[model samples]
Target: MARVNELKRQLKPGQVYRREDLTPYSNAVDRHLAQLVRDGTLQKLAQGLYYFPKKTAFGTPPPNDETLVRSFLKDKRFLLTSPNSYNTLGVGTTQLYNKRVVYNLKRHEEVTLNGKTFFFHKTPYFPKKATPEFLLVDLVNNLDSLAEEREQILKNILAKAKTMNLAKLEHAVDEYGHSKTKKLFRPVLAEMKKTRHAQ
Candidate 1:
């Protein structure tokens, strides 16, 4: 009991923890974990992941998505995004997606943590955050998976692209665009350049 209390003291509210993190605090780690979970002091998010919910006026809210993911991947270098973000670009994407996408150097699998779906995609490169330019390129890269009219979205994306900074958009395309995305944007960019020269 004394050891369990010691372990409980180590936990901070609203923080995610791995099993190994609590091991050193308790002699009987598994037993203490079971006790803590049964008593609602800790919520087991996944196989080895746990979250200490922070109390609030509304109630105990779930752990932050970034905190949950950072602990799960054990890496800080990742970008969290979703298809729903495409709606912000005004490219006619209106569908609300339940799953979140995580672009990271490690892990490529779909995982459900605390009832939320996360699609972890392995990529060699990704921006630290989802910039508007990156989102546009990402929308095209994942176009096939989105629940929208492909042709209409493509047409709208091209029109939307014309209004953005051509240089930054082109840089995003060169860095993050898939082969098909690059191929699609090439002619559009060339035309924009020609128009600028004509003016």
Candidate 2:
């Protein structure tokens, strides 16, 4: 149909869409979407969620987590992070985690999209990007849930904290960190001050 053609033309590969996005093309947009999915022009990720996959020599590229979550949330007010990011801190957390975590004011449950699981947590505050300071605070905040030795994790994080920007780290600890995280950072920061005074 003409409506289908118009809708298809507007869609770009690797972009996700909702039924409402295509509603402007036709009144029976759902029926058209069903047909498109059947014909391989589109792939259904979940209820009312669709993706126009980008084809490569190997196969269709998987949807980006940001795009998928953004589409699902219908808003950009979310932070995408994972436990595996802890590995990047050189804080002795080398274990790879298969799950992704989204920190947002909305959506406090796990959601699966296209066979990938995303754990959403409702938080009042989080940074736009995962900085080293933020990650350190986050690691300690969720330390109990991590699959690493608790004491060793804390020791390594404290050691790593010494090498980071003290001012920014302190600011992050005050802003995004919980009471427990602040308590833990107290002695480490004290040692930093001692080291600074010695210099």
State the lDDT of candidate 2 residue by residue for 1-199, as single tens digits: 9888988998999999988888998768989999999999999999899999999999998899999999998889999999999999987888889999999988999999989999999887888999999999999999999889999889898889999998989988998989989998999988998998999
Candidate 1: stretches off by over 4 Å: none
User: Which one is best on lDDT?
Assistant: 1
Clashing residue pairs in candidate 2, if any?
none
Error of 2 at 102 (Å): 0.8
Q: Pairing residues by index, what is the TM-score of model 1?
A: 0.96
TM-score of each: 0.96, 0.93
> For candidate 1, lDDT tens digit of each residue in 69-125?
999999999999999999999999999988899999999999998889999999987
Error of 1 at 100 (Å): 0.6
lDDT of 1: 0.94
